[model samples]
Target: MVSVAMDAVGERLVSRVERLRALEQALLKAGDRGVRPAELAQRLGVRRQTIYRDLQALADTDVPVWNPARGRWAVRQEQYVGTVRLSIHEAVALFFAARLLARMADEHNPHAISALEKLALRFPEPVREQAMRAAPLLERRPRNREFVQALECLTLGWIERRKVRVLYRSARGRQRHPYVLHPYFLEPTAPGMAVYVLAYEESYFRQFVTLKLERMSQATLLDERFPERDFDPVAALQSAWGIMWSSSPVTVRLRFSPTVSRRVRESQWHLSQQMEEKPDGSCILTLRIGHTLEVLPWIRSWGRDCEVLEPPELRSQLAEEYEAAARLYRTAATADSVSGLRPSSGRHPRL
Candidate 1:
């Protein structure tokens, strides 16, 4: 009698484990749109009461499973259950990357922060200790709250493939324009972690446009849905240098100094980039892309370390900018001299 009772207890434990595993799998597969208890029970070959008990067990473990609507059950955010082993170096690298992302993430959106928290929790004891000590070394700037809110609204539109109306302030001028947009994707832009929405304008030319979220005053998700059959954001950006796309493609050739050649070659600047190393240690990079304006600043960042070899128009534009910058500096120096406003030692005159 005692042996039979012990076997019964062991069987009950195994059954519970199996049921919990099935419940977790169901929740993971459901993703943002959560599975109903009835569906989960049916899929797991269990009763509704058993599924409810399993859900309660998950809740006890602090899983973010919740009912998003009246009857729809979904995870608040996607989560995984697994142990990820990372070396100290990998942990540090991930820590810094997470720090940068956290700085850029929307204040209203807790997804990135929650993910980082989970990652930190999974770190080995020694690495986690080191990370905690190094945490103060990383500085994070507060994100733009208003822009983050706008991003949340746009994200919903993109996820549902729904149309949205945005009151956007133009980048060229500060003019406000109302646009009916089919939000497709969000991309991070450089200089800073600025967010832009890649959407098809429904009201105007039915052309694609990238709107900066910071410039948007409001974004409202509409009830209308759009067919995403042929819309490929990746294909659309294939020829783009950065975010801007152009119908006309241009081949840009640049020569990098030997000092900066290795740095240039180390990074994949574009999909169509081809590099040729010269005997002198200098290198030439050629890229077949459109939207020269987007890459102009990047080229200029190398300064005297880089020279435009092809596309005479881009070279001329760079020359003009250099000349303009030099003129401004010379004017500023002259004014400083005339006004007896010579800066103190180690400090240059301000423009």
Candidate 2:
């Protein structure tokens, strides 16, 4: 009976929130004409008194809203939300950022798409047309309804300073586990093309843990509010090569061959990195990071051009991985040779 009552209350709260959003849109659309409380109530299927209280609530938040005349309400557009004025370079930068955002999101995200479209609408011409064309690119990606729901719940939890319960699966996990997380921050990674939530988990981690959005599902925003705590996300992730962060940082050194040395110098991989150029045209890059696990793949992508120098364990691990991969190819070559397969062309050997 208590559970049912709680659900009922939750439903009413959600309905009221939706109604408030609709009310704002209606008034904003009305502009100078203004909307009557009766019209809003009729549209939203709520009482006129409820619309009045909703307007007052919006006004309490300092929203530029007023009834210009009796029985009509409107948002003061000129004062409510000022016009955006962007120079050409600034406009181009924003357009590029929207393109990055579209690429970063795995699914069609309405909020991101709408934001891009709105920003593009105010851009200078030529670029404006191009920006508008790029805004709907995310619309083609398939929607993940469950992921959207989980994200919305987590967003609300963060804003309300509440705990959220989520069903999560780790990177290599076979089954989902429950976590009661104290919502702290929602972060994004461009290369990884995923979103992450950094939160406190008292049960397992006893500290902040990063949870990937793609791995999380079935999120519930709990009514339990948590006390405000000091957390500077920027400072926390200062040493992170990506989303992963920790208190301990390890020095990493890598030697790049002459072929890829300039390529390595072209970009700053990590903020803490330092370069030592060798006489043989090779260079050793050194950096401090919280963990080496996150950077192993990056090292492997360099293939033979990059060699680990400082961390002996990482060097040994990489060597073992290379050895294993070589053995697999060697085994395949032996099998093909015995089966009369041409060594180079992968065709039958001359009979």
Candidate 3:
């Protein structure tokens, strides 16, 4: 496994690339109306010197951009470029993410809503308002700074073809894997949800792990990076449910009460999830999870309303808990009865 230091450097490099791209876009839009360099910086809320450096960096890269006047700069129309088109699945994911951000008004981040508006610009006018309306129900957690940092480092390493050492803390707390991820994609899980770092955890085994930005502590990028490495993030998460990286796949089945059935059907828990109708008006939901631990708490939350019908292990766990609780109650009843009973005449004689 690679060292953790490389991950830090690589992330910084990726952030620089993205910053440059945004600056480049702003310059392209400035046009012959010729936005002043200072004004461009102001638009981006950055210092003038930073904007100047961006121009120099763009020039250094040999892009045909220049300062036409004392403070004005512009990129040739040919320099204007659009990002790759997103597939429908990606668009839907974005839609949900946009909705989640819109709801983050309570989190004191005006940017969440603003970001959603920016994304809406990509869709048609009619669809835009509808997407905005739908955003709140999909509101996700705010962007985690640590995860963002990890992602930034990973991106640079990928672009530079450098390897990074990630100090990962596993869920079990005992297994710490040094990850060598071939970074390619950044996907937002659900709408408005905090994004996760999707990369390959290369150690004794090569497997994909979604490292929550919040979970990684004391991350630093290394000088070594990876270039020309190819991997698909979607395919890696495709076989999984939620974020658990399961090597051996298992199918999970749940039956929910009628009251919660609509709620279950309305939202997707997994891509492979299939819905089966029960004659008794309950919802039978079936999906495969890489690790049952991820869904264990969720099942327990449903209380008496849900049942784990498949995956004998999961069922057994629930059963074990149920039996343990029953035994405890029975013991408690016996104790209560003994305590409530009047002292026997024999006890008075002994006293």
Candidate with top lDDT is 2
- How do the residues 25-105 of candidate 1 rate in per-residue lDDT, one tens digit apiece? 678678667888898888889899888888889878777778866766766542434335787677668877776765554
Q: How well does candidate 3 score on lDDT at residue 86?
A: 77
For candidate 1, give the lDDT of residue 257. Answer: 97
- TM-score of candidate 1 on Cα atoms, chains taken together: 0.75
Task: Give Cα-based local distance difference scores for all models.
Answer: 0.77, 0.84, 0.68
> Which structure among the candidates has the greatest TM-score?
1
Candidate 1 regions exceeding 4 Å error are 1-15, 24-42, 58-94, 102-118, 124-143, 222-224, 246-249, 332-351
**Superposition error at 179 for model 2 (Å):** 2.0
Positional deviation of residue 95's Cα in model 2 after best superposition, in angstroms: 2.8
After superposing candidate 2 on the true structure, give the runs of residues whose Cα lies further than 4 Å from its correct spot: 1-85, 202-204, 335-351
Worst 10 residues of 3 by lDDT: 102-111
Task: Provide the TM-score for each candidate, comma-separated.
Answer: 0.75, 0.71, 0.52
Better of 1 and 3 by TM-score: 1
Question: What is candidate 2's local distance difference test score?
Answer: 0.84
